[model samples]
Target: MGTTSNSSLRSAGSITDVAGIEVGHFTDTRRPTGCSVVIVRDAAVAGVDVRGAAPGTRETDLLSPTNLVDRVHAVLLAGGSAWGLDAAGGVMRWLEAQGVGMEVGLAKLPLVPAAVLFDLFLGDSTIRPDAAAGYAACEAASVHAPAQGCVGAGAGAAIGKVFGIDRAMKGGIGTASVTVDGVTVGALVACNALGDVIDPDTGRVIAGSRTPDGKSLFDTRRSLLRGEAPKPLITGTNTTIGVVATDAVITKAQATRVATMSHDGLARSINPVHTMSDGDTMFALGTGKSGKTLGMMTLGTMAAEVTAMAVVRAIRAARGVTAGGLYLPAVSDL
Candidate 1:
């Protein structure tokens, strides 16, 4: 396994701060579609939590504690609706090419669990993420903090779609890490929600649906409560996906608990999440390199804290965009 440099990476407070982990992105220039990869070349114990009713996922069942496969090579978050799940194949292929994977007779099958968000509506829907794009993301893998904001799977991400996309704001990728007693826990999130992105610290809407004039933030939760914006739900059209990694050793079941608790961060950051229309998914990876000890309660709480921080970073780092008479603004614009 190749080791990555944390000397500079830690300064950026990125997920790469977790030892032996690398992050990469591949954004399609022709359209706002791409994939992000978290390469754990040495493999790590992994767990996942699918909290939404409509999810576009791959290999989540294998992450169960009872399952035989516990070591994971990489995790992929992408944009393209269900079709985007195909990109995971490319990740697996790349790992196999590098002689990485579980030995199965003469072949080594890489275990790559993935999740996808809906960005197909952002550009030409015909052009979605493919195998080549995933491979490119692998090629771009770096131990340094990756370029966040409007890139990778978050390039075309939109949030606060309670009134559909016309009033939605730009959503993107962000990362943050926290160190506790020598154990480091980090998070990377691609935010594309059906509700507003709020700053949990202040309880203010950050990047979210704008008013009809598209000038000010329209708190989605408030709108729904006041019966202002009510529309039929569009299943499988929205999602927020991310990964939380730690250097502490943990069992697969413990990792699953970490992932589940991370949702507290999502709930705090987003006004309304895990709706029938949203496919919110979270993954937790334990690299077990720190040789540090922490109780499950402490670890899970820190997971949620970092996850929320990353969500705020995604909106703050995001850049606005305008296309086809639709204007999606970032937090800066608000």
Candidate 2:
């Protein structure tokens, strides 16, 4: 929470509260695999941070402050492991159809940076998200908060993978927003981690690895410290990807800083986050629509808080699923 003249928080409760932001999702009904799009149609300056060692990303180098691209049309988060990166092409096509992008020579290139999380373990791996799924997500874009949990990029996400899928619980997308001093800071997260999900406010395990009976949480961190053996990890099996946005005016470097600091949110919510098998990535966007500003410290701090809120929301909102004889329980189920 930043010191705002108004001192009251606006309650849209999603990242869309940030001006010029829209969210859309495309979920494959056959299985929990799909993508979500965050459209910054007004050309928001963007930056990114990749903390997980096994990441699947596209166009991220261009988002660096040193790069030529100053802004991005959209950020795509998808479920399908590395294959999901193809969804970015669909987003590009959708944006090009609407004539959105940077004009270089005779071509308008819609800059869309994307990240993918592994959900291939669920159901049919071959039926992953594709370009059509990406375009369909953009087609469903809306100014509303968009559906959360068990949808879009979060569809196939799961946590507690440190003990394998049998002990894992469902993870999904969540979002939240806070207005500070007339500037709105919002976060959207698709949380699929290789650890337990904790409640930042309560400092307690909310979801994640479960006991053998599947009736209680194992508290993964404590278990590991107490000598419980974690299953062998396959690279790229887990990841948490998302975006943080604000209406405050900020430079590309500052945006990058925000993205970096926002990782604290994941640290707060996920025990043992940013592991080798996970590919955690976050992007920061500045729409500058509020015509307002906050100090880098305050803005970055607020982004982290909002991001944590979104992560917790993701766990709380997730729904249990049973498909193909595989049952992945959600918070509600336990």
In terms of lDDT, the best-performing candidate is 2
Clashes of 2: 0
In model 1, which range of ten residues has the least summed lDDT? 1-10
Question: Candidate 1 on 82-175: residue-level lDDT in tens?
Answer: 8888889899999999998888999988899999999876768888898988998999998898888999999989998988788888999999
For 1-334, candidate 2 gives per-residue lDDT tens digits of 3225444443437898888999999999999889999998779999999999999999899988998877999999999998999999999999999999988889888999999999987898889999999999999999988888999999999999888888999999999888777888899999999989988878899999999998999999999999999999888899999999999999999999999999999999999999998899999999999998899888887888888989888888899987666789999898
Residue 46, model 2, lDDT: 94
lDDT over C-alpha atoms for residue 313 of model 1: 89
Q: After superposition, how far is residue 90 of candidate 1 from its true place, in Å?
A: 1.0
Query: What lDDT does candidate 1 reach at residue 188?
Result: 91
TM-scores for the candidates: 0.95, 0.97
Q: After superposition, how far is residue 116 of candidate 1 from its true place, in Å?
A: 0.1
Best by TM-score: 2
